[model samples]
Target: MTAVGDARIRRAVRAREEGSDLPGVWSAYGGLLQHLRIRAGLSQQQLGDAIGYSLELVASVERGRRPAKAAFTAAADRVLEAGGVLRVLQDEVDRAKLPRFFRNVALLEAEALSRFSYDPLLVPGLLQTETYAHALLGAHFPPLDEEIVEQRVAARLARQALLTRKKPPVVFVFIVEEGALRRFVGSDAVMHQQLEHLVTCARMRNVELQVMPAVRSVHSGLNGPMVLLESMDRRRHVYVDAQGVVSVRSDEDEVSEFWLRYGMLRTQALSTEESSRLIERMAGEL
Candidate 1:
């Protein structure tokens, strides 16, 4: 049993009593973990011993005070003989760490046959190096727990695997603002590593990396960042995120508008070779 004096346990109990929907999915998932643990006739301490965690850590996760990480959940599934029930929730848990609305975008991204993105701030997730990602996520306002931060970093890195799949996407076009490259994310060392990674990604046959110059007289992307995705079935969708709210549009008219806007932005941006040169120059500065 969790110590009654533990702050996390007390907070979980209070939230439960207040009927707060905060962390709803995670709480439900935690409940499922608790149920399975009991069914296996394993005490929390016993489960912790088997999984190489502390009893309090197990209790915190079971009560929804802490997130169940991918590795921990996998161990639980195996120990409890859950038959993949717990393992299947790993993706959901990862998605839950993202802005609630962006979860859908992640799903679409995974199945996209082609993806085009125009980013005016920060490196796009798919192109971010692990150190850059950790720095970016660690800087979130309200300060996420270390466990949650690590989970998000893992999730972002996992998404990059799509680019290396046996049947990689036909096209992956990324137009980044010149300022994003100039801005340091974590440290000089981290930025150097990230820019180096970006240069390598630009060399991929199916990838086109362009940079929107800061001095551009006419900028179509002044409105904000957006992504255009074509699904495996050839259906198109547009996604825009602002102020923590994400809007995904599947309407043909809206998608067409975003497609045209992205084309104009790409044309106004530097050529691939120029972008590569710019990236290399910035990396050299680091």
Candidate 2:
């Protein structure tokens, strides 16, 4: 698990107990605090000096031990010389959008130049449509009311905007089984629309989609789905989302193992062209 995992899980359990969904907000704010502190090259004590708080307070926020107040955010923005970078996190926190695990994923996506994603169950967030997102979120947490459901949908849709931005990042999505396409989340109409969208999105220059058909006798990804994000500075991080989010080390050994696994999965999967045709045919059946 990464630095955010235990804290997020604790927050999630607490939120359930409190009958609130504020854990995600708190997690995102915590991520922002870490990012700014690192970017500003400020040690805990230095950050405290800049923000007029004890180092313990800053540490508490970074660990999600405390909720970030509006004043703390504003002060951090100025002290970190972030201009308005930290302010962006405020909007998501204010809306209480973005899942606790996904808040870290979003931060990585924003800074990444290329992302390698493998999904064993559903499509990745950067590729999901609003309708598909709603269906998935509803299934993930069946008790959510209409209001929270809509907010989750909006949050997922907002993630897709990453692909359309001026300097969009490269995305690679690998799927292990075709059943993910057959399992209709919403109605047939919604599933059909989503598959069609996937076909279109897969054709984009920066996006690469592949599939490991069930017919394959063996697969390296049987261990599970993992994503590797490469930053512009050439740093690589592998993230796996299960019950929670876990980030693999950038150490050569770990990254090499993931690369080997990912390479084997791709080799076992159908070609991009083949996957595209398969998706189109599945959409037709829908």
List TM-scores for all candidates, in order. 0.85, 0.68
Worst 10 residues of 1 by lDDT: 1-10
Stretches of candidate 2 above 4 Å error?
A: 1-96, 171-173
Kindly list the per-residue Cα lDDT of model 2 for residues 1-286, writing each as its tens digit. 2455446545644654376445645555676667667766889889988888889988977765555556788999888777776676665553345655567667777778778878877777677878888878787744877655776677677667667666645555645367667777889988999889989988887778887676785678877778888887888888887776565567878888898888778878899999999999988987
Alpha-carbon RMSD of each model: 5.5, 10.4
Error of 2 at 192 (Å): 0.7
Error of 1 at 80 (Å): 1.2
lDDT tens digits, residue span 163-225, model 1? 776675557999999999888889999999999999999999888999999899578898999
Q: Which portions of model 1 miss their true places by more than 4 Å?
A: 1-22, 142-148, 167-170
Clashing pairs in 2: none
Minimum summed lDDT over a 10-residue window in model 2 is located at 1-10
lDDT of each: 0.84, 0.73
